[model samples]
Each structure stands twice: as structure tokens, then as C-alpha cells.
Target: MGAFSFLSRVLHTKPSNYSKILVLVSVSSGGLIAYAESHSNNETKIVEQSQPEPKRKRVVVLGTGWASISFLQDLDVSSYDVQVVSPRNYFAFTPLLPSVTCGTVEARSIVEPIRNILKKGNGKIHFWEAECLKIDAKEKKLHCRSNIDENLVGNNDFSLDYDYLIVAVGARVNTFNTPGVLEYCHFLKEVEDAQRIRRSVIDCFEKAVLPGLSEEERRTNLHFVIVGGGPTGIEFAAELHDFVHEDLVRIYPEVKDLAKITVIQSGDHILNTFDERISTFAERKFQRDGIEVLTGCRVVSVTDEFINMKVKATGENVKVPHGMVVWSTGVGTRPVVTDFMEQIGQTNRRALATDEWLRVKGCEGVYALGDCATVDQRKIMEDITSIFKAADKDNSGTLTVDEFEDVIEDIIISYPQVELYVKSKHLLEVVDLLRDYEGNKQGEIDIEGFKLALSHVDSQTKSLPATAQVAAQQGAYLSRCFNRWEQCKRNPEGPRHFKGSGRHEFRPFSYRHLGQFAPLGGDQAAAELPGDWVSMGRSTQWLWYSVYASKQVSWRTRILVVADWTRRYIFGRDSSRI
Candidate 1:
């Protein structure tokens, strides 16, 4: 009763005191809310800062040739940490290498630095100017050695770890263990090789004009012999002819009539890879240009002064005197590549064998392409058989037209090479033709008939040619597949659409042959383009220029090529030795 009476008296004491107390309570509540909000914001930022960054996979690419460069250009580097190892630090534009030998184009103009190319990428990329010595596939590592001069101060050997490995080390010139070939012959495969050839040609011209020289000596000094009938050999011969006629004739008249160019080919015809019409055309052009094309001849031995050949038609040994011999007799697997294949237990002796997806056989996380690898056709046949069995459903040994259609669809999804063949009505007609099989008592398409159908598709999708177009396409396809795989890994629940389908599967590589072109002398060229775009002469020459100019790997290189062409046109080739 006393406490109630005291509270009633205090409540009635003053209205001003009650208002001040209420204001103080409200201020304290506002301070408490502000502190709580500030603490929550600070905690959220702290948590974000403490979280770890996602790790990236390591991708190591071997060689900086056409295949490797194309893959690097198309790859999404942000998804992986990339490292490139090669004996060369720059990518040489091989097609223009012939021009370098005669000074039609500068050697440096065709070479692009690998570091410069990597600078254009969004992710960090490391480059090592080294040669890969061995591949430890079981450990996912590569043993490499410095290719730089031994006099230089640097680590001589090192090992690199990789989650993925790309083997693109290209082939080396094949001498077939011929005596004196490697020591005496000049190969036009690199920049230094072209420079050496140029110097040798100039030296030959200078020696031929020397006073008191015998007729035989002069003739031998001015003769240039090229071994091989491939595109490289033919193109080099053409360039040499142009250099002699257009430039050397004006500069050195004393030995003008002494120079001779000869090409020895083992095949029945030069440019045998081309169509018969094109081959005949090229041969006739060579004949008119005074460039002798000796078909059906195999080089037996090479010496400092002469090359001995065995003529197939005559079966007689012939010795041709020459001041310079250029060996472009095709390529063979390098020692490193051969060793890697052997170490990996790959059965292909000529090159590394790969499945249809370009994955190296008998190895994981390893892939091979370019001239170093060949697709295993037997494995592809086995895959085709598995696909056929899958479509047979109900454990039946034979299939109907509808079942065949299902198989075709499945193949189209898995093997992009057969997509074009399968999508057309021609495939349906093929199936209909196979429906009338006499051996099948069930009146259905038997396994033999399926195999026949696959054989037809196989012809269309067999081994791809070892060409720049095929290499570039393969690199692009692999890049796309890797990128898709990375994305699918990040999102396990995603569609997992990769090369063609799910995460575990990859679409077989499909090579599209764009065209083939070769330069003839006197501002003329020849091209066998797809469809009906066959062309030759000056028009084809311009087409060649435009195609190569646009195809230059970088804008800087394209500009330099254009400038070089213009300079050559205005001033003629620089014949003076550098």
C-alpha cells in the first residue's frame, strides 16, 4: 500500500521530467540498433575475405608450330594455367619460308614471337624455350632440357607437371640413314636453313664466274639439285628459278647461262598429290621454265659435289653434279616423339597412335596431333560396331530400317566426321540397298550388312591428310572440347554438352579441306579449291596473296607481309648477301 501511494505521488510531480526520461530511453534504443547493424556488416566482409580462391588446372603444350599456335589462340586460358615448351621461341610461317631463301621476303618478317602471342591472352601463360626430352605419362610430367646455347647461363634440365598435355612436336626431315646426306645437304625447314641456302647459292654464282674455270667446273658450280617432289620441293624450285631469271640475270650476267635447276622425285610424276590435270599442268609449266623435273628416280647417295640417283625406268645409276643439294624428301618422327611412343607402349612405329578423339592410346591426360600422331582406324571400327550393337535393342542380332536410323543418329552425335554423310538422303538409300540381304533369314539388316554400310562411311571419314588445314581444324576442335569439359566440371548438374554430347564422351574430330595452293614462277600461282573454284595464273596468284595475307597469325604480321610484298614489287628482291 505504501509503494503504490509513493508511485502515484511521483507520477503527478512534473510533466516536463516525464518527457525528458522518455527521450533518453528512445536515444539509448537507437544507439543499440546502430551498433548491431555495424557489427553484422563487418562480419559479412570478414567472411568474404577469408574464403579461398578457386584453383585452376595446368595445361602444358609442346611445340609452337601450327597445331599448338592454333590451339593456344582458340583456348580459353582463364580456365587453366598454360605453359608452352618448344625448342623455338618464335613461330615460323613455313609457307613463306621459300621466299626467304631468295630474299623475296625477310626471314624475320615471317616469324612471330611466342611471347608476343601469349601477351594477347587474358590468362597468365608461361613459355620455356626448351626441348622436351621425355614424357612421364604415368606421373603426368615432362622432362625437358634447355635448347639454348650451352654457353649461356641457365638451368640445363627441368621437369614440369601438367594436368593436361598436348604433344604437337612436328616431324624432322628424313634422310633414310643415307650417307653424307645430313652433312652435305641443306634442308629448307627453318630460318637458319633458308639463310644457309641463300649464302650457298650466292657463293655458287660467284664461283662459277671465276676466271680460268673449266667448262665442267663452271657447269657443276651453277647446278642446283633438289630431292623430293612434294609441295616444299616444288615451291623452292619455283622460287629458285625466279631468283635466277628475275634478279640474278640482271646482277650477274657472266654466269647467267650456267645456272640450272633439277628436281628428282621417286614417284611417277611430280606433285603426285594433286589431280592428274594439275600435275600435268605443273610439270608442263616447269618444263617451259627450264626447271627439269626428273620423275621415277630415287636418290641413292649424296656427296659434297654430286647426288647419285637410280632411275626406275632405265635401272641405271646416274650422278648429277651440283653446287647445292636441297633435301626436302619428306618428314619422319623425331627422336623424342619416337621415344615417347615407345615409352608409352604405342604400337604405331611411324607416329604416335591416337583414338578418334585425338587422345594418345595407352595413356591418360595426353593428346597428340599434327604430323606426330595418326588415328587408329581399327579402334574407330570397333567403336562403330559397338554403336551398331547398341541400336540393335532387345538383344537381336539384326536391325530393321528404323533401328539403322537410330544407329545413324547416334553416330552423328558421336562422330562429327560422318554427320554430313549421314544427314543426306544418300545414307537412307544405302540402308535400303542393304535391306535385300540374302544371308539374313530374318529379312533384317545383318551384322555383315551393317559392317558394309560402315565401310562406306569409313571411306568418307578415314585418315585425314597431314596438312596445315587439318592441323588447325584439329587444334580448334580440341580447344572447344577442353573448354566444354572445364565448364561441365564446374557445374555438374549442367547439360554437359561437350564435343557433341555428355561429359564423358567426345565428338570425333572432323577435318574440312578448304583448298590447296602452290606458287608458280613469274607472278603466277595455281590452286585447287573446293567446289568448282579451280584457278591458275595471275588470278590464282592474287588469290594466294590474299589468302595468306589474311591468314597471318597476327595483324602486325599481316601488315609486315603486305609492306614486304610492296617493297619487293617496287625495288625487286634484295640479292645482295646480308
Candidate 2:
């Protein structure tokens, strides 16, 4: 009846109370209609008690990271009922996580609420702050659990259903099963994990300064050992180095030079994933800050007060005592993904097998995207030109968008992303859109006068990423897709093809890799910017700051980061933690 009523209904309050007033609206309208004030569609009819029909196809997407968010942004929202399920309601830009841990940037700057992104609801995409426990492919239902504290509230579990599903659950950091690792090693994967680490680092410095402690105990507590020389581990070690020099020495001179930070990586270099130049530069910087670079080292165990490591070069074991140890290795699949794959029995080589269209093999209404899916996209080789000829029934060669969508949808349902034809991208959009189309209950679609409408079938979460760019990109992509899907549904026969209306129109998703850059202290930094190997100092530091500043998510956030930097220049990085 009004905004208040919609709000009440959405909040699950007294919705009926507000809806009762709707009866009066029709009587008033009927009086106008009788006075020759009739609208074009209904010359004399009075409308009453009508609700917008809920779209039939429910599409559930997992994860709030780069892939899921991107898919949400780009999907046609008007055509289907869309829902996003994830642990965190906000999309965290992961690249800046290390800075947050070191107090260089506030944690809130890198996070954007999921609701804010979905406010432009083209097809009514909803948000669910929970983790998907399991998937029943046969029933098309998801078992989910809220990440919030349910014991405090006494209620939390729920289940959701979907007609089409996209699993974008990403990977988690892997620790290689090191002994005592789960018990003693802190991980820098999440914000809370970082804050806990920051406090622990500060606490250790103070304890080392206590007079009653023996030299061995003090050294053991003051030592900061970071295992894994990956980007996460290196950034953390560098930040700790700055905190000690910039704040620790001045605050507690008694323990000056007492704090030790070590980075142990298994490879010959750190950040092996990046250009060699970036890796070398990172090493020189680490050495300059008095942080140890123990390359070619393997961690054997993590104890309450020391880390047991092995020098791979010599096969000699080494023990480094420490108050806190952080493990920042790369990532691997999570339980939800593995178990679901096994249950489906369609997964091979530890990944979901999908054709070029991203459809799961041996399944219908199930799709896969992002890191969870290992789609080659090169396997598709259907002669799309033939599709033009195929849809040309009686050789007319004229195609309609509505007819095209039906043709392409039917074709893609049988074929996951496997053909060289999928490279056209427009074809991919057609296929992805078909994933949620609800009209074809028989799963058999035919476009009249279309030559290539007949087709065969094909097909295809874990967590959010550590980088914000990936998270944001995914958010934007998914949103766009939903928006377009909605638009297509409104005009089923419009220029947008539903089934080989002879038009090759569809949006394709593309990923642009941005090189890695993180802020290091005092005219020093490291960049893995799309090139060769070798460390650059002094010259690239300014460029590094520029990169970080430009990627602050928004102008307001950039301003906050700039202000924080300026204050740090004048006051130094704050080491005081109470």
C-alpha cells in the first residue's frame, strides 16, 4: 500500500495490518474509473489486492569473494530470483589485509557491505550471511549454517532451494600438515587473526623487557618467526620490522634490537608467483630491515616457544625459538567443495569437470565459476558459424533474439564450456542465461527457423579471497549478469536473443590480472608488476605508494589512508597496544 507497509512486510512484522488498507485504494479507484477516468489497459476495471509475481527460477551463488561478487554484478537480475550466500556480509579487498595487520591502514577501509552492492536489485538478488554446508544436486537444495554465534541466540540453522546454482567458494590457506602448527601458529588470513597477532607482537616485546626473566626466556619471547615467504608472510614480517624501529625502540629502548623477525620459505626465493625482479627486491628490503630471509627451508613443527625447521639445502634441522609464529602459505580446497564433489561423483582429478560453457558434467541446473572450477575454456569447438546456419531453418538466415536465446540456451544446457565456440563470449552469456531460464520444464528447447538449435548436454566454495580486487571484480560481474538477465526477461522477444533470433549478443566475463604491490616502511617497498626478476629500491617505492593509494576502494577511503600516512610520517607507526 505504501513504503511503510513494504518495509513492515520485509521486516516480517504486522504485514497483514498494513495490507488491509489496500481495499480502500480500489474503491477510490473504482469511483474514478466509473467517472470515465479509466486507464488504457483497463478501461473500466478496478485493480485490487495484486502482488508482483515472484520469478520462478531461484539461482543461488556461493561466496562473496572476487568471483561470486563479479558474477552477481553482471548476471541479469530481473530474470531470476538471485541469492548470495557467504560467511561475511562485506566484501573484503584482500590485498590490503597485510597493511591492516600492521596498523598502516584501518581494516574498515577495505570492506564494502554486500547489501550496498545489491541495492540496485534488477532481479531481486538477496543476501544470506552463512556458509553452505552441503549441496543435494538431486533436490537442488543447499544446507547452510550462519557464521554468527547461534548459542547466544538459540536459533540459526536454515535450508535454501535453487533451480540453478553457481558455486564460487574460493580456497583457504594451506599449512602442509606441519606438526603442532594448528595449535601454535597464528595465521594472517582474516582481520581478527591479524589483530590478535598485532597484540601478541606488542605483548612479547614488553615481556622480553621484564627484569626477572632469564636471557633465554626473553629471547624466546622476543623472537618473531614468520614461516612461508609468500606475499602474506613477507608483508607481515616487513610491517613488524617497521613497528619495532619506528615505535618499539623509542617506546621501550631496553629491548632495542631485541625483536627478531624471520621469513622462512621453501623455495629459493620469496613470492615465486610474481616476477623474479619483485622477489629479489623483497629480499634486499628484508635484509636491510634486519629481518632474516631463510629460503629453501621447510618447517617441521611449531611448538609453544620455538619453531622447528629444516634447511633444505643441507638437510640440516634448525630450531628458532619465538613467542609468536605466523604461517602464510598459499591456498587449497575446503571441505564443502571436496565433499560436494565426491557426492556428485562427477569430479575428476580433484576438481569439478566442466565443458567450455561451465556446466557441470553429468548434471543439469548446476554451474561452476571462479577458482573452484578448473575450466580450460579451450575445449569448446562447436562451429558457431554453423549455429548461424543451423538456426537458419529453410535457409532464411534471419535470427531473432528471443529465438536465439532459446536456441543458445538449449545448446548450452547440453554443452558446458568446452568448445572453441565458447571463446566468442556472446555464446557464453547465452549459455549462462539459460542456466536460470524457467519456461523449459521438458529441458528441450527449439527455435523455429533456427538451423543449429539441437544440442547435447555438458557441465560444473570455500572462502573469500585475500585480495580486494578479486573480491570487488567478482561482486561487480555477478551484479551485472543478474541485471542483464532481468532486462532480457522483460522483453523476451526484444533484440536480446532468447533462442537464435539470429543475433550473437551476450556479455562475456573476462579477468584482468593486476600485479602485486604492498606498502613497506621508509622509502622502501616491493612490486611484482608484470615484468622480469631483480630487486629495485628507492625508485619504485614512490610508485608502490601510488599503486596502493590508487586502489583504496573509494576516494573517502583513500583520504583516510592518506591522512593516516601523514600522521604516521609525523608521529610514526603506533606500537602501543594495551
Candidate 3:
């Protein structure tokens, strides 16, 4: 309906022009696109640019990511101003990022374009491809900076104002300040990271084929070193191992013999989050595949030439040169959160300290979720009578490992003869034949054996394996909360705000544990679902494919993904990298 609206649309499609438009338009307030036409009666009827009618409520969601996607799907947009802002314009199906790095899956295959996502909603959802740098709580506005490229916008920076805000910017790869790591090691947190890995890996191979290379020199030059024994690192290593064995030998035999891969883990065993049995299984499997698994090793420093790693076994340090070094350690708070905290003078250990409902403390009309914030899930922390602050927590919810230690003393008095065993024989697997996890990731209940063998049957459960299951479920949780919050706001007298926010008020969110799965490469996968179901091999992969197959954001995307998967299965990896 205004002058700037038309120009905005053009910039939306080809965002490279953002800077130039910003400079040209900065002379006026962000003018909306307007075109005037004269009527027969000398009256001008302005046809304002049309967008999907938004819901009555203004909900500006930051980060078009896992949590926001779920919220968008469930939100009745007819009542809210649903706006999404993020650096990337698409939702990257992160479980497949490792595959992207290994050249097994294309980056586009894992990314669902945001424009397509909104179109499928058939609603006018405003999108600002920018980073939210600040929040003016009193103004109830989101201050954002769009980095659409300086050449296009004349300046790389611009601002966006929003009404209600949801911060879902997820975590970033944490290096723990390892010396030289940030300078030399590559990370696997985004598509750019994956592309760089693939390109640099191939580039190294080409370099190794130089005319005057010695055998030892060539071998060291082609080695790949991976840090972290977590899911991402394990999965990437597995994919790389598969690529070398499956395609590299057949396609690039000249340097195949020189290719070596190693995984250095700081824990006693790989897959430390999984069951001990599973970790042992993975360790043996990696050993069998000629992949050096270095457990109990810490990386002290890394340089362009090689890395310095200390092993507890040798009680000394060692150095190894690698062509590619991928650091897949855990995640930490994102930059936006850190910046926000610094701006607000926050002292919470996390980027954003939130309540159970995921509302940022000291700020109203603003919420934070996903990896960027640390929510003391009021339900999970209600009982800490003498904790950091006055937050709602039931005594039951305040139970920590230290609190559990007190119970052991009482048990000792009740039953004098107490024997403790370290292992768990009661490993219960979920058996949901119809439900499948996205990555063949799994959830299993592993109960530890307790003392006082009178068969009282003590149990400790390790459920849902903190993999994609937790992430997906958390995403779904935020969606439900957003919808509920919108509804409660509309009614005003509606039952919202429960226990923690006030005295015996506010509804608590109960987390549901779903199944977990793991992709073991090639026509192979594994899943443990509810009801003691454990499946693997071709059958598991088929179910896994069909599960995520229906979860694509759009029908066109669904069809493309299916076609691509089938195409790859039949003809193999597109034989080209884009």
C-alpha cells in the first residue's frame, strides 16, 4: 500500500539489493510502497500492497528455527502479527548436516526455504532477514539489524521494530577456549561450515597429489582429525568413514591409501551420553573400521601444521598433522544472547535466564527459548528453598544428585546390608511400531542396579538420549506454548500464568519423552521406541525415511526430498557438488 512496500518485496526475493535500497530510501522514513491512480471522479483509490492477513495479536518471533517453525505451524495467524527474523532464510534440517559435510546430501536438500515455508501457510507473515540486537522492554519493540550486504543496502546495517518478541536463536559451537582452535579448526554448526569442509577436504586431496610428495608426507597430508565424541562428531566421523570406504576408494583411488581419519575424545568412552553398552559397541565398531578412537585425550592447542593432544595413557603429549580438523564439541549460548545480556547488565550464567514458561526475567512481552536461553523450568526447579533467587519450585522438583545422596544415608539405616553394582541390566527399549524418530535416533530406559538386594527394585532411567528427540520435542513444546499464550492474551480472563509466575498460578509445561533413532550409514539405521521396540537395518531406515518424509514443511519440498532420496538411492550422490 506504500512506496517502500513494493521495493521491500523486490529486496525480499533478491536480498543482495538491500543495501542500495536502504541508502536510497534512508532519506525518508521506511516508506511503505504506494502507487497513486486517478479516478473518474477525481478521487484516488490507493491499492495498498496486500499480504496475508495476520492474526490480531502481534507476535514477532526471532529465529526461523526449530522452535519458531513449530510455533508457526500451530499458531492461528488470523489473530497475530507473526514475524520471523534470522540470518539464514531457511530452516536447516540439522540432523543431515553431517551428511552434507561428507558430500552424501546436498545443502539445499537439508534446507527448507523460509519463503516457501510462509507461502504454504497462506498467510502474510513478515520476515526480516536480520539479527535482533536489542530489546526495549518498555517500548515493547524489537530492535533488529539486517545484514543483507552493504553493496545492496548501501550500509550493511538497518533496523526493524516489532511488537511482541520470541527469542529462539539456538546455540553456537563452543570451543571452550582451546588455544588456536578458533584459528585453525573448522566447526560443523551451519551449511557454510559443511560447504567449507567439503571444499577444503577435496582441495587437500588435490594438493596431496603434488609431483614431489613422499609417502609419509602424503599420508599425513590426507588425514582427517575430529574432536568430540558426541552425536554430531560421531555421526560425522561415521559418514566420513563411509565415504572413504564406499566412494573415495572407487572414485579417487590415487590418494585413497593415504587417507586416514582419527577421532579424539576427552571422555573415557565415545557416545558418553548413550548407554555404556552402546558406547562399547561404537568403540569396537570404529576400531574395526581402522578409525583411530582416542578416548581420554584432551586437545591442548592446534596450529596450521598439526595439533597437540595429551593422552592420559602415555602421560605425555603428542602431535599429529591433519589435512582437515573438524571440531564438533558441544554448543553454547549464541552471540545475540550474549549481546542482549551485556546490554541489559545481566549476571545469569546463561545468555538469558528465563522462567519455566520460557519468559525472560525482568522483561515483559518478551520470551526466549531454544539453546540461546537457560530456562529454570519452574517445574524442574520449584523446590529450591535456598537457591539463587525467589522462583517457584516444589520440594519434589528441587531434587538434585546431592539431595538424592541424603536418601542413601536413610536407606543405609533401614537396610544394613547394601551392595552396589555399576552396570544396568534393565535396559528397556521403546516399541512404537508406527512412530519413528527422524534420524533413527532412539530413546531407551537404562536403570542402574542399586544396593540392598532385598529386590526393592530401584531404577535410574536414561530416556530419550538428548539427541534430536529432545530438540524436536522442545520445538513442539514452544509451539504449543505460543498458541496457548496467544489465546490467553485474547481472552484476558483466560487461565494462563500458573505456579512460578505468581502464588499458585501459571500452567506448567510437562515434557513428553518420545522415541530416539540413529543413522548408521547406507541402508542402515537403528531406533528404540516406547513399548520395548528396537529395530535396525533396512526396516529401520525405511520407517525413518517415511517418518521425516511427511514432516517436510511444504508439499513441493516433500516431493523434492523424496525424489532426491530415491534418485540418490538409484543413481548415487548426484556425482556433483553444488
Give one clash count per candidate, in the order shown.
0, 99, 56
* Best of the candidates, lDDT: 1
In candidate 3, which residue ranges exceed 4 Å CA deviation? 1-57, 153-156, 343-351, 379-471, 486-506, 531-538, 574-577
Q: Write the per-residue lDDT of candidate 2 for residues 4-123, one digit (tens) a residue.
A: 475345434333444322222333333321122222333333344544466568889888766676676666666678889999898666666777776776677677787877877843
Best by TM-score: 1
Estimate every model's Cα lDDT from 0 to 1.
0.79, 0.65, 0.64
TM-score of each: 0.84, 0.71, 0.72
Error of 1 at 454 (Å): 3.4
lDDT score, residue 1, model 2? 60
Pairs clashing within candidate 1: none
Relative to the true structure, candidate 3 has a C-alpha RMSD (angstroms) of: 14.4
Of the pair 2 and 3, which is ahead by lDDT?
A: 2
Q: What are the root-mean-square deviations of the candidates from the true structure over C-alphas?
A: 9.7, 12.4, 14.4
